[model samples]
Target chain A: MMRQEAMGVLARANLEELRGALGAWPEPPDAESLRGPEAGLIMLRGRAGGGGAPFNLGEATVARATVRLSSGEVGFSCVLGRDLEKARLAALFDALWQREAEVVDMHLLTLVRERLAGQIERTAEETAATRVNFFTMIRGEDE
Target chain B: MYVAVKGGERAIRNAHRLLADKRRGPRNLPDITLEQIASQLALSVDRIMAEGSLYDRDLAALAMKQARGDLIEAIFLVRAYRTTAPRFGFSEPIDTSKMSIERRVSATFKDLPGGQLLGSTFDYTHRLLDPTLQGAEIEQAARADVTDEDRPMPRVTDLLAHEELIEGDGEAEEGAEVGDLTREPLSFPAERDLRLQTLARGDEGFLLGLGYSTQRGYSRTHPFVGEIRVGMVEVEIEIPELGFTVSIGEIQVTECQMVTQFQGSAKAPPQFTRGYGLVFGQGERKAMAMSLVDRALRAREFGEDVVAPAQDEEFVLSHSDNVQSTGFVEHLKLPHYVDFQAELDLVRRMRREYEDRTADEGKEAAE
Candidate 1:
């Protein structure tokens, strides 16, 4: 079996182009149609239990763009928050990310991931500070 | 408002709110601390950590608290947490030989080195409740205060090795030879690494029942607990960039080795057999049960016929994990409306065809 390291490189590269090839909102995707929440969920983390340690607060709301290739494979990319430009970029990549797309190259895909990663980092600073929540302990009868 | 069945989103949100409210039943009560669960409910946390394949006592405790004492749910929480946590590096293979033993015992010998320190076992304890624990004056036992430096532990394997009774020679299996269970789907006729990996994270109850079944005349093999060891082992990680091994942390582990009596064959010498088991934390019953099942799984090695259910590797390993079993079972409750609608349409068509065939036969007879 091929080590996981090889598979990771393939998935990341494929996903970027796959997410980018998806174009504008007017053009409906050819295959792999979906009807669900446009905004995806991203888990934001906070200090674990009020200075006790670090842990996940909960899923943060984010706008995601998804599109399917002509061959019926779907790709998805979620941004930090509701950035329409980011969502469009994600959509374009989603449309072109597949191996069969034959239009985008690996070099372009790498550039897309780097660009997306940068955009995400910038937007994350603003959104991360706002939605911090700590779950109160839920009591049971035995307690 | 002529909308047709459009309030599902609102209804789902409201239902979640109600569930949250119900989860927090009474606000007046004092909160249960993670320490309390870690100390008092240690067994449940141990099982959770074992099945979840992540050994964080505090997180396991939190999972238990969140799960409302359901160990399986706690295990699920721990598993979810495990998935999200980024993998920094791999830990060094724990040296069971150098384990700082807390509870050690052996059934193979009447006496052995390091002495069978029955140390903190519930085996001899009466089932009767101690009313003193319920009193307000409940205090930590004096024995609890004893430090690790005061008493050192020696492995039971060392004793067996000392006498040369056990087969102690096997090449160290390289890490590259082992398959990663978490990353890939398991295939049939798995290697010992994959099998042991699955059993290590398998559900306690499932393994226990399967292990028990073997004792009830299913490929019966007279087994003895050659050794049972429990203690903390330091987790080490090799840094490729740094070119050295570094200690990450420590985790409590329970290890069991069972020696089964195997009859001699024409080609091979008759000798005592071995079955190995290891689990996170102090779970003797699970470890012992695992050891028995592990041995049973090695039926092919002994040239024995695979007539028993426990001897079937697929049956034993596949069903041993509660998380996988329960998840697949419960996933049936998810939206299957599409599949159900298709089935319904097929059944209606079949009935119509059957009625038409019977009518044609009657018409032919009349003609």
Candidate 2:
């Protein structure tokens, strides 16, 4: 069953679990600490940054998270938002799914995927809106 | 009509079976053998090995067969597999000067030390469709053996050095610098090393097209094949524990050194400058294209104005990888309905607001 779940994730290109386990956190996540499977006790060391790249004041806050599943999957998640705890929880659930196949009910997959899609859309919208600021680059005739 | 809720697990299982069937369509047909692909379609295997950055011919052949002869897909397969393999150590640079020359030619010099062996090349042959080759093996040509005393293997660069037609080789730079492409994201205005690394894994078709553009007056720096040599070179690696170098298995390589004429500058008197190109197996076209592009990219180093697509670092490096290009191109097939829905809602709201404002303006004007 575990092998089957792993294959499913692999074929689907849902390698977030493997990436998180590699401890490839953009920056240390800052969320509520969560115990993981392969990884012992894990916690998010979140920070407001540009996907781990250095950011200054007035820049958008990016949330990061880390966790470990009971089945020994050390996972980390980085998402752009102010909800550090939610990001951490999502990452933990993802890692838990990686370790424990039974946790990945069909209902859960659909729910998580829907939530992620919504979040992505919101993020994209925000980014696009932010790009449209300078309203006046008027032509010389107007001047 | 009333419908029952379908189980997700069952739907997933059915999808998997369908995909499997698609991948292996009509199993009643004969299975494709890796060896058949490797031997019959050697050129495709060569391409995969060249782009994949792995030297395993068998694996490349297998990838090609599995990808249904899609060379780019095979390259992607090899590249993905290559990432998983552990890096042991770097091989000592193969000295091409000592290559057991099967085919060596220099277009620049007429009668150099090593008399140019025309070797196996389609350059002189008429591009006629030979119907006989479809089913028959042509009789082999008689081999000739010239004595060692008559043979002269002098490099064309040696002649240039004598005539003072080119700058002398500078002392080798200290320290082996690490390439940044595999580790960090590609940045604009790349350094020489980064540019070379990017070019090495670049899509052959893209590079060839850009190279052709340069020839057609896009960024013309007249280039000539100074030398194109194809042969096996020994691979050696030094073990720190043993304190001596040991031989690793040899691999075939095709090397092309292009000499291009550049205008002289105050700091450096320009004669003919060199651009080096090397790739695994007998891949002359790739090597020549690489050499041309390499020379084109050296514009900044030579203080020449970078003007064309071939001379642009960001343009070249960003669009180089076949894998990245293929993935991003094909990823459009994946579900993006949610994003589309959001976009739809946004457009609807904006239209409604515009219509309401316009209606108010119309009413006021009528009043």
Candidate 3:
């Protein structure tokens, strides 16, 4: 379950950072060669503000892939778009993480967290720029 | 009382041949190409695609040709063809907020973040027919002031949202189930998803009339068009094995957002409510009409009384398909002589009985 959560975070990480982390790993897993990548779409759902009932927002295309290692452990990765290489790499990393948790956790997991944090920060800044506040003035009759 | 009519197969075949000849129209004239229809009569193609619930421009053009330019028939042809297509998968929800806009306008606000772009609209044009367009070779004239920029435009609703004047998009729970009206039969009171799906493919004329009825005090809700945007958005599909997503293709779409005043309720404060419409191509009028109908249909959900035909979900959705309507209306041409003969017999017997009664009354009066 912990590994699965880690894999989800990894899946959502920046594409470039995920790719780079996968490259630096020693004896990179060949799990992608065993299983091909698959790409498709998933309908995105939204909720009303302040945790209201969910509604269908629209459809978003997503690519996902799963790979099984020689050991019983299976790794899965999914992300938004048709990027097959990114999906394959993420799946391979997921598989590797299960088999060699110590190395994968030390190297790939840290990078994923940093990239995610950076992304959140960037979004926050952009949204902050568009923020506006309105105030009404009191009239003489309002004494 | 009626013999069964038959042996019209040969006549039917000849009639079909004649129809083909008529559709072709004078061999000396140049045939209308699919490209011409797709490009020149783009709005028609767009309507067919939108109502047909298919997105292929080429296929829509072909259906238009096969339908002899009958838009509803073209829609039907495209819809029939769509049944044979394999379901690849549902696309990720397009972020209309990020659309590279061609045209963006709002009736509510005069000045907006994306200053109104009245791109390629007939809003200002006179309705006079141009004789010059009749069999004339069209030449492209270069405009000196054309400046193309791919800039992201902010949504007008979002601007209202900042001031807390408009209701925010309700928070959805993670992994919320969305209804697919195409696969599952539509049941009411429907979720907004199902309602939207039905309206997206509903007959534009029917929706337009319903929308107009609402405006004419049937269910008056003072609506302001928050925004009408036409643009292209990238489509991306996830590759699971690759653990990432990539762009598949882009499609042109028209999206409309309508804002209307809502009364304060115990559950929430008074705020501007929204009705949304998104269609396959540059369908501004259809989108606007769809938004109006969408708003009307939400009356029940908003705890407002449903007093109009547009507010009735079954009335609007069940009768909105032109193909179904046309089939039903045209079915009157089919022979119903046997049924009519039974009524005829009953009428004649009733008339004879009345005559006898009148004669008996006359004899009684004479005696």
**Whose lDDT is greatest here?**
3
Write candidate 1's Cα lDDT for A1-143 as tens digits. 11122122222333334344443223544544342225433332212101112222222234444556676655444333334445544444444445433334443444555764564344333222222223356689758
lDDT of 2 at A21: 38
Candidates 1 onward: DockQ, in order: 0.01, 0.01, 0.09
- Report lDDT (CA) for all predictions: 0.61, 0.59, 0.72
Ranking 2 against 3 by TM-score, winner? 3
For candidate 1, the chain B TM-score comes to: 0.87
- Stretches > 4 Å off in candidate 3: A1-143, B1-6, B135-150, B353-367
What C-alpha lDDT, on a 0 to 100 scale, does residue B166 get in candidate 1? Answer: 52
Predicted candidate 3 versus true structure: per-residue lDDT over B1-367, tens digit per residue: 3447787899899999998998899999999999999999999999988888777687789999988999998988977765654344655566677765666777777767646766557876898899998889976422222222324577787777878778765655578776776568878778777777778788999999998998898888788898888876655545454566544445677888888767687877788887777787899998889888888888987888988998999889888878778878876777778878899999999999999999999999999
| Model 2 chain B: lowest-lDDT 10 consecutive positions | B169-178
Docking class of 1: incorrect
What's the TM-score of each model vs. the native? 0.65, 0.65, 0.70
Residue B286 miss distance in model 1 (angstroms)? 1.5
Per TM-score, what order, best first?
A: 3, 1, 2
The deviation in Å at residue A34 for candidate 3 is 14
Q: Which ten residues in a row have the lowest lDDT in candidate 2 chain A?
A: A41-50
